[model samples]
Target: MQKFPFDAIGFDLDGTLLDTFRDLGAAVNHALVLGGFAEVSVETSKDLIGGGAKIMLARAVDAQGGLPADEFKQLYKAMLTYYSAHNAIHTVPYPGVREALVDLANKGVRMAVVTNKFEGFARDVLSQLDLIGAFETVIGGDSMGKGEDGQFLAKPHPAPVIAAREATGNGHMAFIGDSTYDVRAARGAGVPVVAAAYGYCDMPPHELGADVVIDSFPELIPALEAIGSAS
Candidate 1:
């Protein structure tokens, strides 16, 4: 067979490679109850995932009359604590993810994960799932360090995506994700992007402006092949 299209691939963790809504939702509820707030339906976690844990809890709390800043800070901390231990309980690879990943590796494609989750948590969860070994590197939302604005240099910034590409050997690359954050980051990094429509997309798949849209993880290699052919 002819060589594959790209030299490397970068992936987004939650909602893209893994179905983490249930575990993430549980963590959010754990914090909500501690703050004396009503627990949100776990399914609601799908809508709040792309932004990361702090934002996930913030949205859930804000929906119920909101909370004082200091109180909310404490609750966010609580959520993190709870998530650290329970993140992998219900989290698992999406359908065909394993086979696709192995196929890519067999094709000599380097792989890395660029996620909005904190570094430690991302590593821990991936480790628990035994999936960490598949990636050349894992770049978390906090991995790039804070910028002058006192915020993490993460997705929507392109820094992490750029870093992932560089880490994976800096050749032709493509990014796969389910959210606008992923699309924007991949575009900013000047690579073709494939949107994962089956994941918890923050917007309609086509509207996300990816170079291609695929309905499931199994479709990835063909999508990348198409991207390669066009490029």
Candidate 2:
């Protein structure tokens, strides 16, 4: 077999590795109810993801008439509190994720998960699902600390992905994700990227600007091999 395209692969947690919209949506609904807003359909929650829990709740709240900053903050905390306990109850890996991960490991490739979810939350979910051990490290939005504006230096910043590369030995790296955040992060980090079309894509798969777009996790290896071959 030909050499694997990259030495390390950094993956986005939600949408890319796991199907988490149901739990995310539930948390958003919990916050919405607490804030006296109507709950949105769980399916629509797919569109609210990609930023983080706070943003997810914010969007849902905003759609219903918005909220005062103070009230919103409290609601955000409530969402987090509810989520931390029930996050994995309805969450599970997307099809072929486990097999693909195992295959990557057998290829001697290094892996890391870089997500906008809080570090503790990401760790807990992955650990509960028994997928945490597959990664060399799990870098959350908070892992890099907040920037000058008090916002997390998370996706689209490239710092976490670059850090993932460094932690995985820094030879050559690739990113796999499902949103513009992931594409921008990989581009900023100077790595090729594969978009997961089957995941919770915020835009059309072809429009995500990935080096390649895969419809399923099972297509990932072949896509990466082709990308590596061409590059």
Candidate 3:
């Protein structure tokens, strides 16, 4: 077995490991239509991603016209209901993701998924895609529970990423993701992060302030290796 750089690695789910925009967009559209808003192109969901499903739908809806809180809550519920059943419809591992994962596993690297999605939803989607077993744990936005502000203590908060490292039983950890949320989380946790440029990045990948940036999953190992070597 090849020795790896880090003892544990965490990944962001939606865009980093899988292309889930289509299904996410579909859910948003379902909610929007039910709320009497014009449906948006599924492709537009890519721009609304990174913050989670609720935020994704809210962004799309807010684009048309902001909804009343109670009404938006009901629409959000409807979207979750629709998404739970169809989360994997058009979702698939990004190109080279599986191969890269296999390679990492072969190197005996412990891995976890830290996503802004709800824990149950993340697990369900991963399970449906036959990718759940690859992770030692899946830490989601809801996993850390609602904060005093009534918001999820998720990425950009550092709690989930820290939880992932603990769950994976690794002190030396690294994170890979596509969004500023991921970058911020890793930074706040003081862990090295690699940006996935091919994912649904909320900002320019180069602007994410990652320790390294990779254009494809296949580049992950090398990027990690480089980080390791430099350290």
Score every model by TM-score: 0.98, 0.98, 0.97
* Residue 35, candidate 1: alpha-carbon lDDT: 96
Candidate 1's TM-score reads 0.98
Clashing pairs in 3: none
| Tens-digit lDDT string for candidate 3 (1-231) | 446789899999988999999999999999999999998888877999977888888898899979999999999999999999998999999999888888889888899999999999999989998889999999998999988999999989999999999998956899999999999999999899999999999999999999999999999999999999899
| Model 2 pairs in collision | none
lDDT of 2 by residue, 44-154 (tens): 899999878888888888888899999999999999999999999999999999999999999999999999999999999999999999999999989999899998899
Q: Which ten residues in a row are the worst by lDDT in model 3?
A: 1-10
Q: Give the RMSD in angstroms, all C-alphas superposed, for model 2.
A: 0.7
lDDT (Cα atoms) of all candidates against the true structure:
0.93, 0.93, 0.92
Shift of residue 34 alpha carbon in model 1, Å? 0.7
Give the per-residue lDDT digits (tens) of candidate 1, residues 1-231.
789999999999999999999999999999999999988889877987886888888899998999989999999999999998898999999999999999999999999999999989999999998899999999999999999999999998899999999999999999999999999999999988999999989999999999999998999999999889888
Model 2 alpha-carbon drift over 4 Å, by segment: none
